[model samples]
Target: MTNATAPLDFIRPEVDRALQRFVDRRRTAFDDPDLAAVLGTVRDFLAGGKRLRPAFCYWGWRAAGGADDPGVISAASALELLQASALVHDDVMDSSDMRRGMPSAHRRFEKLHVDSGWHGSAVQFGEGAAILVGNLLLIWSGELWRNSGLPAESLASAQPVFDHMLTELMNGQYLDLLAQAHGENSFESARRVALFKSGKYSVEHPLRLGMILAAQSREAWIDQVCAGYGQNVGIAFQLRDDVLGVFGDPAETGKPAGDDLREGKRTMLIARTLELASPAQAQSVRALVGDPKLDAEGVATLRTVIEDTGALASAEELITTYVKEAVAVLDAAPIEAEAREALKALAIAATTRRN
Candidate 1:
């Protein structure tokens, strides 16, 4: 690939600068110290993500012959705000205690309530404050995107995609909740949840938004890329995440070991395990998977069940198949050479990371 710049090195600092400037400007508009604490917590949470969405957006623009432009960088950086908003809300939804090795937004707010001896239920206060913080980030994302200095026509062209992505995300989130409520554990149901909840927004829409902004119109090839390469990579990316949620170290993943098991997330891995497990194995999983007090021993037991069921191997194979198909599409795509190489590397990075 001839030393193509890694997106983390090339794009993250610029995105960080844009985010910092946005935060500074917003700080001036709000004077309350309590609000400042909320803002600061969100800001710190923003600092830790891999910045992969912006990277995909940038490469998609590049693939469409877009030049280096600060306007586009600013526009792409808005995705980080959108991501932060999702994570803060997601942590609350999952009741996750930590994020990026620190207290999650809700937990932090809950602690604040307790420490300050607030006159209300600390748990409710924390969750309410985190929801407001998430909403604030969502509002700021729109503001940043609209003010990104891109041409009005380009932004206008991409507006529908940007809007649709958010709609899809909300729909996916609700579907996920519904699946959990109903105890739906079929692989097909799990795949549906993965596709809408994380896959499409994480990859496909970001790529489409970037390409549409650059091309200033929809193209047949853009749709093809999104549907083929984008879709596969997105699903594979989420699958890889499901694996990490089970097997990754807390020091690296920034959540408790087997956090997904504790959350009772109906992920593809869990679905696959149930499909392959013996009656006793399935029974053990059913008993242990949703227990909030799952300790290292419980985690170890579930890990053994998942491993012995061959579900882990099956999920890994699926990830490989998806990545291979995505790469094959990229190989035949008529795009900029740098973008082609970068996209290939991105596919590997997305699916193979330990955390």
Candidate 2:
């Protein structure tokens, strides 16, 4: 058999090229130097991603008997733009300083403000500019999807899924904010946030959109495939991310070690830790998890507490369970054999990645 990841590797360059062409075309529409800087930032931001969403969409189309087509690849690439928009806005909201080993959009803009000696507060200017950049990416994602050179009827057939995916993503972002503001840390709340914010848009909706576009309508099996395979794999993917946020390497993840803990993200891993922790351990985590000024020792202390409480183990078990569930679904799915193997590989890759 071909390498497990060959399918994803095959599509990545195609998607990147599509993104470059789209951005280049957009560049021709604007002439301002400041706008050029914004475009450059967007281009750079769009450069780094796993492209998992596009991979899922592509394989979904293939499974539905869609032949190889550049137009399909173009449509799939739009998901990367959507992903970029989400990340830029997420960094601004979280006050994140770095992403993919570079200064985040807001921080970059903030630096520009400082360097230019702008009159207003640098922080506010950075955040405002970053928000506008994110909005531009979101708008561009839609435009790209609509103008991907696919037939109008096929695009229309899949439009609702795309619309709903965006809606769910926004709702998930709000839910994440609310979870933090209200200090809601239940497993259920964490799962809900993961489902809307990342999981649906990350996997289920993308897959469904691809299938719908290929099949030219929402078929019965498409819904089953998404529900059975997409949901479980997506949630598992997020759970793995929760583990990485606390434990992943900075070199691999492209962020500071323990950055998510510093930002006080109410992730499932944290919720599970609190659930299983001793009173003293829970108190310690509560004191340390959200401290923006947390030092290496503080991070070490939390890591010990999470390990001692067995939350890490529990999270791993859940991740394994979800992936197993997804694999079982894939085994029975009527997808083309090659695509089935590719998706199974993707499920493992998504859940077990270091970054």
Candidate 3:
């Protein structure tokens, strides 16, 4: 199960296979034709993703002395299902058109509505469909975790961490919605939202999940070390996401160039820009950055202001600080050498990747 040469090479394909079999069985059990389309949507949504949470969970287990068991991988793969639920609901909330270079689940439902000549409002139907599909994914995620074929005791040990991980994700997402609604853009607020909504779910909890599944050590301090590393790396990961939302290439990012700006996201980048930009520049940015119909020229102007104010550099520096903090934790933790190296690689990838 353990491949010291390439820690993740065996994981990704095995995880994908596990997901395929899980979904196929579900598809078989739920045979309603109307349910069929929603199941299909959920399947497709789960098909393509970076699978970061599962990766972290796998390594965390390894670091905690869990062997390379397909059951561990299957349990870890449950994170992807939960992630799909989050993303689908998020796209619905954001009213996004695309995800990973294709129509978002809600948008696809909208098209289905229009194509089929449904009675009710297409937009409403799309949103409803998105919500239903998201709920289904969440349910299936729990199913995978509970029935992963891991030992009963291991599943029991991991349950609390798993439950809290999702609860934090939901709370964080709500905080994000509030930040947008209130038009809040302070760095503190942004960080709080990022920590709960993304940092914990994406990194912290997943690592903790793996650690719990291992049930190797009941010591409290070991859990702290894992959490510390996960939290810092999670912050760095979210920081990278915020930076990419504004500056990443649409082709690579699979999002509109100024999607975050248009969505009025109160990210660190925007908060820093507000702090550093000249009064007039700040005023102009405030007026246009959040407009739903923000244009290319508007995005260009905001980009210029962001660059001139050095907000981008500041954000990058913050990311570096978090990454360093995470590395320090890894260096001191009692992890296997190979597992430590894999965890370090995950941290680097989270902070530095463009998309």
Candidate 4:
């Protein structure tokens, strides 16, 4: 189902109001007219995301019995700002020109280069501009969190979780880069990447941070439970993304079909395919995987080969396993019955999402 019709659609509107305020404040800080363009880029990048991270933060606070405090709202909104920073950087790293069916921040800058007839290499200009904008978003995210009207103790308690999330994200990005370079997309390696990159930051840490800010007495146990839930949901999310990358309709996904094959992403599906392929099939798959020149027909061939080897089924099975485990974790948590049921629904929705 579309996010507009999803159960949590109301949360997105609330978050959007906060985000617009944040963006206005951001634009007011700069005196240079050119900087307005930069701020506009940031605004565009922040728009249209699923806002899943912030929603998780909100739910975590509720699960811990936090009141609907303004501070909680601000803190949750900061998560989306942080996510925008990451996505801008990630798009640059991935050499992705388009995001959410529009030019990425870097690509927009590059296009301005050509449109304005600016001197120098557009590629370098775009990369440099996008990096600075990403940094700005990161800094503002921290500022939002610090100024969220939370008590000093609450802020202090949540700081470490936020810090570790960013650190882990960087480390996870590095691991993904290394894995890509070394062609080492084993199941174990992919699991680690998912945990550090998406699981912790995308799900667990956000939840834990909200819980910490709420000053829940069972924070320790809750953190563990959140981690387990995040691990399962995060991996499931990534696996679905991989499937979408290779097999989804381009019109719906807003990404080129087989983009992952073109980028040579060493996903779990690819790893499993290689492990289970017959000798000749394995050789054919290996030859096509990292070749930048692999065409649409080649990608289709590879997809068929992968499916024939049962890798697709294996990946789907793993997703089911993780989702089941995550449900169990939530079931055992000490949350209020109503909040627990809502959290369970969220878990199911996140893991079973089609887009």
Candidate 5:
């Protein structure tokens, strides 16, 4: 391994440029009056995202000895489009009002409805519009992937990964909904969601897709490395997110603190806290766990309870453990030393980042 500032530099500009071109093409091709508004909303949602998945895809391809070609860049950009579609829908499902420092897509549409004095339920209108827009992005993503100009076999090899990624995302969402509804919150259950819903698609699958696109012959090894890497980074990423949902600054994370608590997210932190709490502490946490009206003081108290019960430290320790494991996987991957070093840095950055 050699010195590298970050893997981000390799793909950020490429993905951005590709996305801009795609968006421009959409605008020119679609003459609908709502096109501008839709594009603007999409642009806003995509503006400040870390673009981590696309970067992973790009590096995965490069690490597999892929050339810096237009097809590979476009394929990575398509992954970003798919990610945007998922987020737009995910925010709506979560009833989240903010994302990436702006109103969520549904919220933005709802505001537009109210501001224009449009008839009917502004909330429904916003949600409906956002759903349609998300579907459109999904379609565009598919089109981009199909037209990426890779060799026929390479394109064919990459298709299953794309399909499987979407399936895992949907399954994860379903698991999340079920856990919330049934109050079946447990550490094991949360870990299941984290691995399937987030870890594989967000980190592992993207890397695998990139490798496939690069025509790697050792597909099984690539899968193993990416899975190992993804599991560690993905779980760590969500654990960090669980922490941020409680302790992160609203301005930095673009969401109010304790939002997860309010939503009663069955995250590992919450699960561990519940497990570790005393009878009195357990009752206190259970009483407030799913309450939407939990006040700032109540939220503060819950935070203290979690910390005092050692859940916070436990989650942090898990994050540290996973990050180290991911680094080890990166070290073992049969890639150029430079690529391995970049991936190690990425794993550290992804796990340790505050937002």
Candidate 6:
């Protein structure tokens, strides 16, 4: 790897190369062009991300003094493959048309079906393709984890954490779909969803996996410290995402303005808005939000309601509190100095990231 000229960039290219190499190898398993599209589409879908999970995992390893290990980096990279599966399946579940400012995987396959004049409903073909691709990525995520060149014993130790992470992720998805279906309008429910969906799976588990890989029988307090740190930071990260989904620039967020509102996502922001907004404003918003055909004007109307209700500031305050708590966890954490500073920067970046 040539110089990427940044502390975090050092790990990024290695992860990217691993993903690409893994994808290339997997492509060989399919000889037919149609079958090969699944691998190709997944590769493209995995191209862009902040790679926060992998970074957290890597930094956690460093915190445990397992510095500069190739096996750790490769294993950490596997989290991205898991993330790709989550997002692809998430898009299918949400029926999202776009991802990362491009056509979503399902949409791409749907277009492919229409352009090729293939048999059966284009929607069904597209959804089926996306679901299969998600499953393939899930399968590959495990393979990449196992093939990371770590000692068999060390990898074995991380197995339970990895398995639990996957289980929580799926359960969280079910909760999300359930909440959406029933229009359950509770802030507590949204927070629960965030805790399982993004907090545990995306941040805490990956960080813990790194620590476990580093020392299968490490100190208990150390693991507790990292878990607490990751949990708070992860929740703050997702809340920030909720903010972006509403107020962020479309070009940067890879979604339309107020996309969460349009989706009627029972996010904490929405719940807060509902809690704080006056009865009439709340009534008007409830009427307009989640309308698939809601125009920009309607989005504006809802944005004003959110602002007027003080939900945005409330959310920001919550983020600040969590960041402070996360930082406080590091004060006594049994980690080396250099890696601790790096982790601090990551906490800031994950919270402040624009995309």
- Candidates in order have lDDT scores of 0.89, 0.91, 0.85, 0.80, 0.83, 0.85
User: Taking the candidates one at a time, how many backbone clashes does each contain?
Assistant: 0, 0, 0, 0, 0, 0
RMSD (CA, Å), each prediction? 1.2, 1.0, 2.2, 2.2, 1.8, 2.4
Cα displacement (angstroms), candidate 6, residue 242, comes to 0.3
Could you give candidate 3's per-residue lDDT for residues 1-355 as a string of tens digits? 3332244465678789999999888676668777777877877777777778888899988888888888888899999999999999999988888888778999999999999998989999999999988998899899999989899998888888888888888998899999888884788888889999999889988888888789744468557876789889998899899889988998888788999899888887888888888889889888987799999999999899998999999998998899888889989888878778888888887787767
Any runs in candidate 2 off by more than 4 Å, and if so which? none
lDDT of 1 by residue, 283-345 (tens): 999888878998899999999999999999999999999999998988888888888888888
State the lDDT of candidate 4 residue by residue for 232-337, as single tens digits. 8888878877787788887676666777787777777788888899999888888888777778899999999989999999888988898889889988888656
- TM-score of each candidate structure, all chains considered together: 0.98, 0.98, 0.95, 0.94, 0.95, 0.96
Q: Per-residue lDDT of 1-355 in model 6, one digit per residue for the tens?
A: 1221233676688889888888887666887876867766887888887788898888888777785888988899999999989999999988888889888889989999999999999999999999998998899899999999999998998898899899999999999888888884778889989989988877788888888888775468767876789888988999999999888998998877877877878888888899898989889878987788888899888889988999999999999999889888987788877777777777787888787
Among the numbered candidates, top lDDT falls to 2
Candidate 4 displacement at residue 132 in angstroms:
1.1
Clashing pairs in 6: none
| Candidate 1 vs. true structure, TM-score | 0.98
lDDT per residue for candidate 5 within 12-111, as digits (tens), equals 8878888888887767655777567787887777666677888788888877888778888888888888888988998888888788778889999999
Residue ranges of candidate 3 with Cα displaced over 4 Å: 1-10, 216-218
Which of candidates 2 and 3 reaches a greater TM-score?
2
Counting only residues 3 or more apart in sequence or on different chains, how many pairs clash (N, Cα, C under 3 Å) in candidate 3? Answer: 0
Judged by whole-model lDDT over C-alpha atoms, candidate 4 comes out at 0.80
Regions of candidate 4 where Cα sits further than 4 Å from its true position:
1-7, 216-218
Model 4 deviation from the true structure expressed as Cα RMSD, one decimal place: 2.2
